[model samples]
Target: MTEQEELVICVPGQRLCVADKSNVAGAGTYEQQGYIYSKLAGIVKLVTDDKTRTVEVHSITEQSIVPAPGDIVTAMVTVVNQRFCKCSIKCVGDIVLTRPYRGILRKEDVRAIDKDKLEMYKCYRPGDIILARVMPMTEIHSYQLSTAENELGVVIAHSDEEIRQMMHGFGDSSEPLFESAKIIEDVVLQQMKIIVRRACEIADRRANSKKSNIINGEDLLFLLRKDKIRLQRIVKYLELKELGCSVQKLMTANDVPQNVTDPEQLDIKKKVPFQSFLEQIDNTGELLENSSSVDDVKRRRCIRADIASKSMDEVHYMKFSKARRVSFANKNRHKFSDWICADGDVTVSKQAYTILSYLAYETVAQIVDLAFLVRQDQGKMHGDAIDRQRLNYINPFTFKPRYHSKNFVMKPLTPSEITEALRRYWSPQLDMTGPFNRWSMRRPHLKLLSC
Candidate 1:
C-alpha cells in the first residue's frame, strides 16, 4: 500500500527525510546535514512538483497575524523625526486590524521624485492618517513603510478647529448666492437626508414583515449599512442611541444559554444520558487496577527482563552507552520521541519508513498556501448566470473567498485543486528561505492545471 494510510503526529527534532538535494524543506521543518527534520510539533507532508521534481514539508497551524511586505496598510502617525516617522497600523488591506503593528516611514520614502530635498514636517505630522505599503521587514519591532507611490500618502490630516471653521465659513453667509463650496455642501446634505429617510423606511418595512411593532437599533444600523453608509459612521450613530445602556451587559446575557444559567428550571438532567455516565464510573476502578498492575512484582520483573534482553540484542544501535539501560526518567522526558506502530503485528524497523513517509505527506498537505489560478470553466461568465446569485456560504452573505480584491480578475484555486497544483509546481525555488514570500513576489502564472 502507498504511504499516508493514517495521520502521523510529528514532534520537534524528529527526522522527516534523509536530505537529498531533491528534497526541499518547507515550513515547520529545517534541513540539517543531508537530512530534513521538523522544527515544530505538527504533521509532516511531502509534495512533489511535476515541473521541479522537488519535495518540501508543509506545516499548518493558527499563526499570529502580522503585516507583511507589500501589504497596503492604513496607519496613524504617532511620532516624527528628521529621518523617519513612526506610525501604528490600524488596518491591513480592507481589514480593520488591532494589536498594534508599528510602522516607520523614512523621509526618502515620503515621495517618489524628491529624495534629498524632502522634508519630514511638510509631509507628515503626528495624528496624520497615512496610507502606505509595507516595505521589507528590517527589524522585529516595526515594519518599514513606503508612501512613494501617488496613491500612498496622508489620506487624512489632523486639522485644528480654526481650519475647520474657516473651511465651513462659506455656509454661514446670508448672501443670496453662496460660494461653490456651500452649494456643494447643501446638495450633499439633501442627498444624505433622502438616503437616511429611505433607509428608515426600509427598516420599518422589514420590522413589519417580521410582525414586530418596534424597530431596534440593530435593524436601523443594518438598513443604513445596506444603503451604503460608512460602517464607522453607522457604528457611531448606534453608540449615540445606546449611550445610557451597558452594551457589554446585553452581550453577556445573550452569550450564556438559558439552559446553562438555570439547569434545574430547564430540566437538563432529564435530557442528559445517565446510563453512559454510570457505565464510565463503574469502569474507573477496573482502569485504576490495570494501571497499578505495572507495580506488581511479577509484571515488573517481566518488563525489566524483556527490556534488558532487547537492549542487549540492539546494543550496537544505541547512540549512547547509558541507553543500554534506559531510565524511566529519560523515557518520560523524551515521551515525544516514542513511536507508535503503524503495522501492529510487525516490528518497528519493518514499518518505520512507511510511517515516516505518511508523516511527510500529511505535513505538506496541512499547511495552507494561497495561489491564483485561472478560471477553467466559462459557465459562471454569462451576465444572467445563476451561479452569480447562489450563496457562497450559508452563514455569511459575503461572496465566496471573502478577502478577495475588488474587481479581482484572477480566480483563486479551489482546495481540491491546490493539492495537485502544489505537487505539480513543487520546485527547488520553493525550498528557498522565505519560500512563501518568494512565491508571492513572482508574477502569477496563468497556466492552469486540471485535477
Candidate 2:
C-alpha cells in the first residue's frame, strides 16, 4: 500500500488493517479473518486508550433521535372519543419520525388545571394532529401521551387540508411536480409550515387556549431549508425505506430555530388597484398632444402602450375554412398570391378564407370559440393590420371580447387630416431643423390596397 493510502479515510466494508495479536478492532469497526474492516463509512483513527492502541472509524452522519419519556412529540390523532384519543407520533422533538410510534392521550391527562371542566370531544377531534409530551410507560401497547401543558395540543387538523392545498397552489407551480419533484417537496414543505404556524397563532388567540410554549412546524421547516446535508440525509432515509434498504443515520444537532423564543411577526399587504394610468388618460389625450419634443411624446406613448397592453388581452381568431387549392393550370383556380393577399375588407388570404368558408359551411357550431388560427401569409408581416384590432368592449366578469353592434372596426384618419392636425397642434412644439421635420411632407398614413 502507498503511504497516502495508509492514512486515507475509508467506507463501510473496507479493510483497514490486520487485527492480530498487537492490533485490535475498536468502535465503528469489526474484525474477521485476522483483518479489521470499517463498520461505518467515516474517517479512521488510531487511538491509544490506556496504552492499548486500536483503530476506529468515526461516522460523519448524524445520529438518529429516538422517542423517550419526558420528550415532546408531535402526533396525529387517529381515533378520538370521550375517554381517550389515539395518535401516531409524527416527530420526536424537532426531528420527524421515520417510523411513527403509536400513543394514547387520555381525557384526564389533557390539561392539568382544567381537567374537570374540559371535554375531550369539544377540545380535540379525530384527525387533529397535536404536540404532546411523552409520559413514563404505563401501558404495554402504546406510549402514554400528555398535552396537559399549555403549549401541547392540536396544531393542525384534517379539515385544514384545503387551506394547505391553497397555499401549495400559490405561484401556479403545482404542474411542475413531476418535472422537478425535489423543488415541489421543498416548496410544499415550506408552505405547509407557514400554514401550520398561522393556525397555531389563531388557536393561541382563543380566550381559553394557552400561549404555545413548544417548538412549531416553522422551526422544523427552517431546519430542513437551511441544512442541505441533513435534508439530503432525510431524503436518503426515505428513499431507503421505500426500497426496503438498510440505512444508519443520525441528526447532528437538535434542529430547532434560535428565534423560536419569540412569537413570529405577521405582515399582510392589501390588494389595491393601480389607477394612475387611468387618471393620466382622463385629460382627453392631452399628455400625448402637449409633449414639448419628439422624445417626450415617444416616452409618453411607450408608457401608455405598456399600460394598454397590460389591460388588453390578445385574441387569436382561428380560420376554420377547408377549401382545397385548385391546380394553377385550371382557369377557375385563383393565383397563389391572390389566396394570401390582405385587404381592409378581408384580413385572411383567399387560401385561408377557403378553409374558413369550408369549416363554416360544414360545421353547425360556431368556430369563433374554438382554437385561434394564424395565417402563414401574415406571419412575416410586421405589425399586421389584423393584430391591431382594438375591442370596443370587454365583459367584466368573463374578460371576453365584445364587438360593436354593426361588427365594423373604426376607420383610420385620412393622411391629409392627420398632417393638418399635426401642423396645427404639434409642429410648433418641435425644433423643426431637419428636412424631414415637416409632418405634412413625411410619409403619408395612406392604406395600401391589395392587388
Candidate 3:
C-alpha cells in the first residue's frame, strides 16, 4: 500500500504513470486531469505530454500493482501540522512497503470526535503508526484517507516489531486490542462471505415468491447487514425496503411477517416497553441511520478495536479458581515482559483486559454463557436474572444451561468486570465528524435520550 512498496493500483477509473526501481519505465508516464505521474518507484520518472493515454512506469515492480477499493494500507504519520497530518503508505504485501507516496489526512478524518480542540500530539505524534482506510483518491495523486474508523488507527505501538506483529495478529491474542483485532479479521472475512452469499439467496428467494412481490433496495441493505453472504445466494432477490422482509418472503415462498410485535397483539409498539423511547420526535433514528447503523456498529465492534472500555481498578475475581489461569496468562504474554508495556501482563488499554481476561482466559463455554446473556438482553427479556421468563440462546457446545435455574447459569457482575474496551494507541477526541456507521447512529439516540 505504500508508495515505495510499489505502485500497485491507480485511481479507481484512472491509471497513473509507473516505472521500475532501475529507473526504467515499465509504462510511460501520462497526464490526466491536470496531473501527471511525476514520480514512480524503481524506474526513472518519465515526463509525458498532456495528450498521452498511458503512463510511463518507473522501476516497475511486479507490473506496478494499483490501489483499488478495500485495500488495507499501513502508513506512518510523518507530518502533523495544524490543519492536517501527512504520511506515506507502506506495505502492499510481504514485499515490505518501500516507495514513500504522500497521502493527506485532513484533521476531520483523523478520528471520531470534535476537531477544533483536538491535540494532534495526543492523537498522533510525528512517528505514530496509522492504519487507515482509503476513502478516496483526490486530485494531484493525493489519497483522501480516513483514520476515524475503528481498528484503523495505530495497532501495536512501542518500537518492538515482534510485539507489533503479535498485536497485529501473530501470537495467541493476549491483549484486548490484539484479540479484538483478531476478531476484526474474522468479522471482515465473514462480511466478505455475506456479500457473496446474499446474491444467490436473494435470487432463490425471489424465484419462490408466491405473490411475485420482488424485493427492493431497502431489503438489499437489510440483507447486507444481517449476513452479507446470504444476499448473494441462489436467490437473486431484490427489495425496496431496507428491512428486506419482502425479499426474505419471496425467496422462501412465504408471507413476509408484518412488523407487528406480539404474535397475537399485532401492534409491536404496544407489546414492546420501549415504545415511548421509539416514539420520541427527536429525529435520532435518521441521524443514527445516516451516521452509523446499529448493526454496522456491532459489526465494527468485531472489526475494529477502537471501542470504549469502561475501566476500573484492577479488582481480581478471587472467588473463581483462576489462580493458575492468571499466572499462566501473565507469564507467556509479550506485553507483560516489556517494562515499557506490560506490568505483569496487565496493559493500559481497556481492550487489553477484554482480550486477556475474557476472550483469552475464559474457556469457550464461559464465552458462550456470556454471549447468551447478552443476546437475551437483546431479545428484550426483562426482570432480574432469577425471574427471567426464558433464555434466548443455548450454547451449542454446552448442550444445556444450569438446570432448575430460571436464567442461564451465571454470576452477578462485580465492579471490576470490564464491560467494553477499545485497543488503540491514540488519544481520545479524534475527528468526531467522520462516518461512525452504526456507532455513529447511537450518538443521535444518545443525544435524544440524554435530554
RMSD of each: 36.2, 30.8, 22.7
TM-scores, all models, native as reference: 0.27, 0.25, 0.25
lDDT of each: 0.43, 0.43, 0.38
Q: lDDT tens digits, residues 190-304, model 3?
A: 3323322343345346567433233233323333233323322211211122124434444486544554333343222212211233234224343112232344322432332
Superposed model 1: Cα runs more than 4 Å off: 1-46, 53-63, 69-72, 91-98, 125-128, 155-451
Span of 10 residues, lowest total lDDT, candidate 1: 169-178
lDDT (Cα, 0-100) at 231 in candidate 2 = 29
Report the lDDT tens digits of candidate 1 across residue range 146-243: 99998989887652222112222211111112122232223222332332333345545765654333323333233323222132332333343233
- What is the Å distance of residue 116 in model 1 from its true position? 4.1
lDDT, candidate 2, 186-260, per-residue tens: 322333334334334543553247764333222222323333333233333334332221111112335433443
Q: Model 3 off-target regions past 4 Å? A: 1-63, 93-95, 158-451
Whose TM-score is greatest here? Answer: 1
